[model samples]
Target: MSFVIRNIDKVIVGDGKVLSNADIYVKDGKVSAIGAGLTVPENVEVRYGSGFCAMPGLWDTHCHVQSSGGIWGVDKDMLPEAKAIRAAAQAEPVVLSGTTTLADAGCDGNISFALRDTIAAGIVRGPRLLICGYMIRMTGGRAGKDTEGEVDGPDSARKATRKMIAKGVDFIKLGATGAVSSPGMKQWSPQLTLEEITAACEEAHKAGLKVHSHAYGDEGINLSIRGGADVVVHGITLNDENLQLMKDRSIQLLATLSTYKAKLPYLDKLPRWQAVKHIQVCELLEANFKRAVKAGIDVVAGTDSGMTFNYFGRSSRELDYMVEMGMTPAQAIKTATISAARSFGLDHETGSLAAGKAADILLVRGDPLADIGVLGKAGGVAQVFVAGRLVAAFDECGKEIG
Candidate 1:
């Protein structure tokens, strides 16, 4: 299929540049040309926009499509088919929100790989997916049988990683520290031995997959750094040395916040001890990331969506929080676009509006660069495309393209 998206009033390159009055030509699911007066064959589908701001579709680095149930992550009590159904349902609205690519952080069953395949086969309308079948953790760690990749030693870690590789996970997810949401758990406490984490990272890297480290506190953050984590999930307690180490190593940070469910409404529901612990972690989130921003760390964007109250399609709210923390609007968007792509090893395929990348595009009625908040508003994105094909094009109130 071919497409000519004409008369785009402005385009956010997903780098730091913006172009005006540009047109995009897409052929075979990739961008063929990008400039003014780009002409295509008459037989190609022509899409004329009425005052739309175009840009690369958004990228969300961390998500949990399977964690659709209430607070309890996985109900082993539920049938596997039921789990897959809810997870699939959660994926539908992501493109409508302008996120054309996302990754499932970790889930109980290996259903993530199945979902990835279904989406690839065009059987499902969702973003391109990278998935971690199960997150490797220590026995009795934060997640129990619900989703444990429980490994006790280096050997076990390597074996578990190999199993995930055979299961066809695109990447490996590891929990280096206890979660902040489980207030009663020890904060900043290490869950896996450095040796175990090292083994997992080494095995996954050898298998050509990256490892994402789930860390929150001091020691846990350090273990993620020294243990060879490629991406840090939430280093809310990172210190200066940790930031420098990550920068020197080129390790990336997902720097997620909103999806942790650490907000007041959720916290109020927590037990006093847990709520107090969560508040401590929350207090450090902005300051911790600001230090990262100052150190020139590769801070990518991710919403630990599906955790507590974080929804799937509302991933753009993460960009809003990023701006509030310290990034300029452009930089914040870059974290979601180019930076995220680079982190996930997908930059060559998509994440930018260049001529050779995948033609995953989004159209908003007004300029998102002028008011980044517009991206977080309903009906702000007028259209969404995946692989150069029109997937969603309408207003919030049901106005279809004329």
Candidate 2:
């Protein structure tokens, strides 16, 4: 298939630069040529830009496309079969929301990857899936209890990682700290020892897989870096030394700020019965996000979806949080579009709108660069495309079909 997306008022080209009156030629699921006023062949499809702004499709470096019913700070029992159904349910709206590529954060293991494969085959429309089959964690660690996978020592961690690799996973995830959802665990507490983390990272690296770590606080962050973690999923609170270390190491951070803000509404009018532990998470996020950016660490975008009101199909709220943290609109967009793909090791395939890259792009009615809030409004994104094919088109009601 070939098409000329012509007369774009402004095109966000590669490297975060915008071009005026540009046209994009797409052929065979990749951008063929990007230029201005290019004449087109008679047989080629001509797609009118319609005064909308064109930019690279957004990417979510971390999300959970699983089924767990609960409000933020609340937990509910979930069955594996039901979780698979819910994962498929969430994926549909995500593709409509303009996220073309998503890194599912360890929602399945070797046993559950069969369900993931079914979802990939066409159960619903969503971003291309790059899954971390099952997260490796010390026994009783964060994701371990929730997802039912755990390992204590080097040998066990290596064995578990090899099993995931054998299942053909794209990457690996490790929990270096106790998570907020886990009972009696502080947000900053380190769960996995450095030795365990190193074992998992080494095995995953040897298998040519990227390693992402869930971490917060000083000890957890340090362990992640020392373990050679490629992506730091969430570092909600960090010290000066940790910031410097991440910057020096070029470790990418996926600051899923919305996951914290989603709890604000619950706290504003909290009853005495409500738990106050979640307050710690909010406090740490405010402190760490500003510090990480000041230290010049590359902070990418992420949303810990499936966590209390953090919906799978909605990610624009994350960009809003980035702006609230003092990032300029362009920088916030970069976090989700280009920087995110780089963090997930998919920059060669997709990210920016450039020749020879996947034609994953979005058409928004207004300039998202002028107002980051434009992204939060569903109406702003008029059309979404994946691999050079139109997948979702919205009318007045945001009634989109893929």
Best lDDT among the predictions, by candidate number: 1
Model number with the top TM-score: 1
lDDT of 1 by residue, 190-281 (tens): 89889999999999889878889999777888898899999988888788888888989999988986664435577665557656776787
In the range 98-131, model 2's lDDT, one tens digit per residue, is 8887777776533236545764676566677678
Per-residue error at 183 for model 1, in Å? 6.4
User: Candidate 2: misplaced stretches above 4 Å?
Assistant: 72-77, 108-116, 143-148, 268-274
Which residue runs does candidate 1 get wrong by more than 4 Å?
73-76, 146-148, 260-262, 271-273, 396-402
Clash pairs for candidate 1? none
Candidate lDDT (C-alpha), each? 0.82, 0.78
How many angstroms is residue 226 displaced in model 1 relative to the true structure, after the best TM-score fit? 1.7
TM-score of each model, paired residue for residue: 0.94, 0.93
